[model samples]
Target chain A: MTAPAAPQTAPSPAAAPAGAPAVIRAIHLSKVYELGAQQVRALDDVSLEIGKGEYVAIMGPSGSGKSTLMNVLGCLDVPSSGEYWLRGQEVSKLSEDELAEIRNREIGFVFQTFHLLARQTALRNVELPLVYGAVRADERRARALELLRQVGLEKRADHKPNELSGGERQRVAIARALVNRPALLLADEPTGNLDSRTGKEILELLDRLHGEGHTILLVTHDPEVGRRAARTVRVRDGRIESDAPNR
Target chain B: MIALLEGVRIALQAIWGQKLRSALTLLCVIIAILSIIAVVSVLDGMDLYVREEVAGAGANVFTLRRVDELKVLTDLQVFLDSLGNPRITLADWKALRAEMTLAEFVDPLRSRSGDLQAVRDGRSIRNVDLQGRGAEYPGIEDLDLERGRHLTQADIDQRREVLVIGAQVAETLFPGVDPLGQKVRLSGRHYEVVGVFARRSNVLGQDRNIFAILPLSALFAQFGSFRSISVQVKAKSLGDFAAALDEARTIMRVRHGLRPQDPDDFNLTTAEQFLTLWEKISSGIFATLIGVVSITLVVGGIIIMNVMLVSVTERTREVGLRKALGARRGMILFQFLVESVTLTSVGGVVGIVLGFAAAFLIGAFSPLPYSVKPWSIVSALVIVFAVGVFFGLYPASRAARLQPVEALRRE
Candidate 1:
């Protein structure tokens, strides 16, 4: 299935039922931390709606709770005292197993570190999600090879992650993220470990994916990266400072 | 379930990464199974030899001796009481042989208590077992002559000073030169060698080739009177053996006037009894072997658990990466369990190979034949697998319990 599979506009007024969901909707979401005696708020009273086929960047400096919002939005973590609805289902009350099922089926995560299993080849690493998805070995191998070809790494499909350059590793991670054809591509600092020359190449890949009607959420501390998105949400001090559409 | 194959692949890779440590960990388990199998094989071989060779070959042949005790010595009271009881003698043998209608042959055999020596022209062999036998003894005991002729009934009727030595005694006393008709002195009495026995069977690791046999009449004439001796009785066939044994027992009991309530003072030893006694002894040895081996497995398992825990801690980041890639906790747990089972099962296979080699060595160099009990091998596999599962649980679960975020951040 492709992104915007059941596209719903952001906060439609009286045109749709209350039960209809956008791609992602968070209502008064909050996350509190308990470090010894201190209760630091990671997210507080944040409400947001992300529709289908939207490239949204959550930009913030360190400790500005952008990571927290990304985790909550990707279903890696649950928010405190709030409701999170993804693909028309409330997930705040879901158990860990249910949340894991949601993550595997609905969200594709791209990490800054690449997180490729070091011992496995690029093809094997790409096929990991399909393995957990109960796909047969022959089909998984074929699909993983296809994904590698899309990222222009067909020749390097048998190479381990360490054998590849930083940009190549990021591309492999992107291929892995899209292998499951998840509705939302959630990338957390997809180019944080790359140089500017390599980082721009990764951003170009993201731009092409978005052009093909993929919903992308890029979280970064760099403003240059944030500006590439059509919509940017700037977070500071555990709250959103700006939510605006860019040209 | 499909991921089990992948789990095995991962486990193999992990073991390959630490080859030396894996070998060392397997050493304890290897040695445990090796020694257990080797020891059990030896005991099993002994039981085989006891049944096949030492039980006197044929089921129709049985011995009537003084004591029923097979391996364990009789208690002091039983021994003292047996000493008071009448010794099995020539008259008792004759009387028992006369009353048996189903009997084929009865041979009276008298053995000297201490060691006997034979000397010929300054060459002497000490520790030669001396037994005086009737002419029927050769047929009943199946002693094949390698040289010369057996003592005829005339040798016993005339009370001739004729002797038959074993092949080894002939080799020791009269090497190279003809031992037939050679005179050998025993206890200051000279006797002409009439026959030599063939070296065929090895019994209880003792040299049966060092036997010295003489006529019972000559033995009585030289040693005053026959006192303590055993009589071997052979039945006509397997079908009538029970009736033959009952007739002998009845004649003997009537001769001794044994009351119904009183147990027979004489002991009856059948080939079956000897085999059962061996089984009892070997099973005890097997039990002891299992006890010693289980200790090794316990110690080995504890070491494996410690090593696995360290491995889990070392590979925490890899676990986090797998979990993030959609692996469930059960998958992670199964992966580690497979690793340990692979380690021990590999050890078990190696141990069995080494154990068979050891048994072969014993068979090649020693009198004991290499006998491997099938159950011992099955138990070794079952035991090693159990140790792996039992010891690997804590570490595997610890690895599975690690949170993806926490593990990803670990060094």
Candidate 2:
């Protein structure tokens, strides 16, 4: 258990206007996973557009393919058919290594499980993305320390994941996600494992990041969580049911 | 280089995490390398010792004896057959000395070795090696005198009962006093000491300076002339050696009157032949041992491969996470390869140290000397490093080829 960190100065917002061009454009994207003799449509003809500095949530029930949609959007899995263009680059047909490079430079992922490496300290976890980016050691440390400070975890930088509480771990994950300064921040059920009080705190942290003009695409099944986003897209049976603003 | 360092750091953590398993794997590698190092070191030491101390004094010299060959000691039938060969006598020595153009010296020597005693001033030394040599024996062998003189042609012609004593014999009988002109009793007869040979250290752990020598004629007068003798012959130079041997062999065959198709009745032992025989024996042993150690090393390598496979399986999710973080397949492969190399190299170093200790202990307690050859150390390290790379390839590539999404999805 640890005391909550003091709030620091707010992070600068992303430099994109309200009517900026799209950051991600999925045109007729379909993902079909083959299991033995059966083919499951994980994503079916999904067409969507997300501009820079927008906070959007894709919501659905179990088996509705929201996770698959998030994976495709995060460049983790390729769609079976479609033209997926990210920042004017057609990436749906990219090679494995090239996609990995795209994921490192253009997208940041925050998993539901808070997937922090168990052995490393919080500071090292925050520095993980920068390490893959081939950042120099001194610069990597300084950037990681600054991100930790932004997440109000500078005082706990040396603590491993097992020593931190659930909320602190999620905060460390958020710090790691932003360390690369990616174009899109994609989180899957970011507050799924926290209590109501801690969950609210994480939600507030997400809201603060969104307010800073960061492009946030969150995936969840809970409507109350979806209601926090500025825009919501509903999916059912691998197809979008509705796309609308929260108001 | 960064990947190499990180790979080593990760490997150490993994090894430390599984202490007993890593230790057992390392032990297997150590034993395999230790046997090779120890055996090579002993062989190297013995080769040098035999060449310098044992065979060096007899360089350019060869011996003609009644026995057919040195290998007669290994076969009973050969020994029995050679027993019927005529004794090498003074006649053969004289013929070779007079007829050979390539010959430097020809000396006849007869040895008596069982339960001989030398007594001087009532002080006795038992089991003394007693030998009789012709006047030119010193010229054919490294028989330097500590004082006085060697046997002269006059001593042999007059049949004088004069002796030359080894340093050990002199020490035991004369102690602090001068041995020159002193009388020592041997075989119920007294002989005046004319010379004393300088002290010599042991060869193959057996002392050399424990013998007494007498003039050939005087020895025949006392012990009769029926004993088997060896004719030692030296060539003028290395160029003359082969021709000298051929000439001596032809002369002896003519003297014995052997038929054209018949084998020679006597044996010839040269310094080169003795060294070659030793090399054949030592190399035979080394080849068999190396074959065995190679199998052990391969087994050790298999163990490493198995352990690495287990490690990759255990860390599948971590590999997925690393891949997700943008680590390429080559990076993953390099990391695991570095790990395996570090493991085997560590084992190689430990084995060399332990092998050196084992060699030193054996040399200290026994007659076989020990030397650590630089090439052996280099070869041992190279062998283990190659094992690591060869065995580690499959597991590392398996780890590298893992699909990132599937690996990450695995619980």
Candidate 3:
């Protein structure tokens, strides 16, 4: 057989415009949690770059480093070793207050459990991030309502979390995540608690958001969910196994 | 402002969510505030009643008497006697009226008790104590006569057998008989009842309404001796009352042969003095009761802290979620603190209402004096708020220091 020719490179029309910054960059990041006598290396020597407006999924099995990486990216916790630069800010070195500001202004988080405040209405849940942002009351209400409308939850805005169905509650959480108009949307198993059909709908909604130039980072264990992303990163036993374009 | 309102809203919602626990927690604060209010109200009412009694007794009157520090000491008595006795007498009263430029009137009174009897239409009354006085007695003392006339100078000069029976005596000896102008036999002698004196309400447990008033000559004739005499002096104006008293004292000292350095050998009791005594007694009770109530409040505060600590543990996941959603430590601390204060303040308000109701019921139906003071209510509120803040600090700090990841993993 003839030796395979070198793969041809094609000029792509969808390439990022010049000078667009990477939305997230992690360099040699590591997280070690000490539990009594033993230490857990949740993330070890992880380095990744996600460009602006990219939809990326982190796929891993249980005990993998995916959740640790998500937490570091979301500024919820600092890496034990190395730097995380989120939108040009050294988030790993930031003070807790600064990290909170970044979390409020830059990253929107959607958890798998849909952690909505139980006593608060869907509209109030959406307004919570604005409360932390110190937005004026009227503006917070208006923006929260608009975000709930964007998630197709305007009619259910007055319903409390316990009163909402699983899909509707997840949608309220999504609206809450987007209420601050964050630059990056981070979802950790956003469809883990949903029916397959509802999960597909959520993925479609996220895809539409990505099409509108929103940067999205989704952590999941399902191959189907990973395939929907433009890029897929696989983690196992605290290390990334492979990273490649999803197509 | 919005943050504060939101804090309050969330705090109230949390309290509402755990209604039974909230009510139980609030009970401690309520009891503390109620204790404070009850004590304060009773003291206030007692003070008011004492002040009214003293003012009614005499606002501008002062009595001067000898003060001996040693009990049963002959030297003090000899010294008091050598000072020539500042005991008020009729001559001293005349001198006081003459020399005191500020004196409006003066009267010397000597009390004498005897087995006096009054009979009307075959009914008889006994055991009356008689107070004999000059014509200035009515104006010098606060006595209201309901019928006929009081003793005049002519009555004393002629030794007329006229008497002013007190309301109790009149009611007893001549019930439905109109004691005015009626004849009543006293100590084997008959005296016409010229007037019936109105009842004098008791002060500090002494009833003035059970005695009879007779002319000074008649009491002297009946008793044959006087142990002590009281001088009542009136001043033209309140500003001059003290000056008039001083002038009367000087005139009495000169008449009684007292040295300039010798202190008056008589008791001087003024309305102001009685008020000071009353306040001292009431405030001592107040201090003791407040000390006990303070201990209760401290206990209440500790209970609040313990409950809040448990709350922090119970809601660890909620705290983690809040921290993960960009909540600062200060925000977490403030939310918890607001909840504590809200709980305490609600308890305080309830306590105040209950305290007032209790006080009103006591005041209306019982003999124990009770009146709630506005300042006490305000102070109780402040104390409750302070206690809440003080006790809430530790639990709030613990909540704020919780790591989001650790709290999330706490199941």
Candidate 4:
């Protein structure tokens, strides 16, 4: 394990005020995937908006189009038709390169599988986003270190995914997602692979990050994870069912 | 770029994770490059050895003979035709020497009197390559004497029983005593030792030194008339070699009374002919080598492409994750190329090292002075990289073109 590095001086993009401009706005968006015989509408006629300081949970059971919605929102996929705006940009119409840039600069994702590169250590995993961002090596190291410290995994910076516990690996994943200081932290089933107690610990960490004013879009089927968010949007059979405040 | 460094890192990790697969993919390249480097190294060494040997004797020197060796190799008709041609006799050598104007020296020589054995005080040197030559033979060849002197014109004309022994012959005949002014028996006849030629380079073979020289008069007197005699001719200057060859050919033709339509009965070949013969032989070998090695490399490349396709398929989720994390298609493509290239480049390096070692071992045990050319090494490396990129293209593009959402959704 390498020595714990000094923290980054660049502040995280987590200081949005309430009622700030909406960072994600979708208007009647749809996504269709063609199978051999059937046309699978993974997302259909969904309209939604997420503000800069909002903590929103998108919930749906398996094959409910919730994953597709998260993918589209994270700039990993574009809608088949309809306008989708991310941070005032029409993301639905963006080219692959532009979408990649948006994903690098504006969206940070934590996947259900942890998605940490198996060969890389915790520090290198966190440094990945900055590498895509073309950040200098020294700054990448410092920022990844700061994110690791923030996630309380500073001492485990050099530990590979296999060496870390499930919850600890998720923490490292969280640090990796935050390394670029992206405006949107999009997590897909952040606790799907963790035990109930570890799941709660991950939720508490998300809660603390939300308290710091970071915009979060959590995708999960679990009601417990949804309840932790300020708002919940439920989807079923490729269409939005309800959008309501958690209170 | 950071992308390149990261790509290399990813490739190395991929290779480490699947060593057996990578080694299997690299097998063809290794074998192909190894054989090429080894053969080319030995061949190149031999080439240098021949060229140096020829150049030492002087490139402008040529032998006038009854049959050309290259003609025997390249033409079936010439082989039959040359066999019927008249043996160039002492009379012909005398005529050419008297008539030639451009030649600096025209020295007649005769060999293959392999039956002759030299003895001094009952210490005989057997298996000697005894050559009978005119006095000017020393001028046309690189014969440097260590003691006494070459047989002079007076010695050749007066038919003195004078002999110039090879270093090997002198060593065997005179052991501890100076060979100069000593008497040796040749074909049961006594002859005075005129000179001892310097030890020749043993690069080709040590057997080159086991020879003795006798004046044509003395040899003819002792061994009777020879079958055919060859004359060594040297140009006045290196630049006048063509002119000298033309003059000699024209003189010989006029003397033989040959018509312009008829091919000359005598063969004219220069030291360069030896080098050219080697080149012809090696080029045939080289072409066949290229054919086999290229097929192996191409087949290896195809296998690598197949393996890369499998690798890309296996890493769909990882690709998707990287794409979602902001890796562009170009980055994905470049990373895979780096992987393929690293695999083959590593093989190329190993093969080259093995080739050098093999060449060294072969040269050590044999008379071959094996050496590797720098450009062959460079070209082999370039070939490795080129093959990798060419073969890696399809698989890398396949990985690059994947939609992140689709890829991420793969179970």
TM-score of chain B of each: 0.93, 0.85, 0.80, 0.85
For candidate 1, the per-residue lDDT at A176 reads: 87
True contacts kept of each: 0.22, 0.33, 0.43, 0.71
- lDDT string for model 3 (A107-202, tens) is 898888888888889999999888888899899999999999988989998999999988888889888888898989999999999999999989
Candidate 4 clashes: the total is 0
Worst 10 residues of 2 chain B by lDDT: B112-121
Instruction: Say which prediction, candidate 1 or candidate 3, comes out ahead on lDDT.
Output: 1
In candidate 3, list every pair of residues with a backbone clash: B63-B267, B63-B268, B64-B266, B64-B267, B65-B265, B65-B266, B65-B267, B66-B265, B66-B266
Using lDDT, rank the candidates from best to worst: 4, 2, 1, 3
Error in Å for residue A126 of model 2 = 1.8
Off-target runs (Cα >4 Å) in candidate 2 are A1-21, A235-237, B1-5, B12-28, B71-86, B118-132, B143-199, B204-228, B257-265
With a 3 Å backbone cut-off (N, CA, C), the pairs that clash in candidate 4 are none
Off by over 4 Å in 1: A1-20, A28-46, A60-65, A79-81, A92-98, A234-242, B26-28, B56-58, B69-77, B113-120, B373-379
- Per-candidate TM-scores read 0.89, 0.84, 0.81, 0.86
Task: Calculate DockQ per candidate and list them.
Answer: 0.41, 0.35, 0.43, 0.58
Per-candidate clashes come to 0, 0, 9, 0
* Model 1 agreement with the true structure over B92-120: per-residue lDDT tens digits: 88886787788788888887732334455
Superposed by TM-score, candidate 2 places the C-alpha of residue A237 at a distance from the truth, in angstroms, of 4.1
Error of 1 at B167 (Å): 2.3
CAPRI-style quality class for the chain A–B interface of candidate 1: acceptable
Q: Highest lDDT: which candidate?
A: 4
- For model 2, what is the alpha-carbon lDDT of residue B193? 90
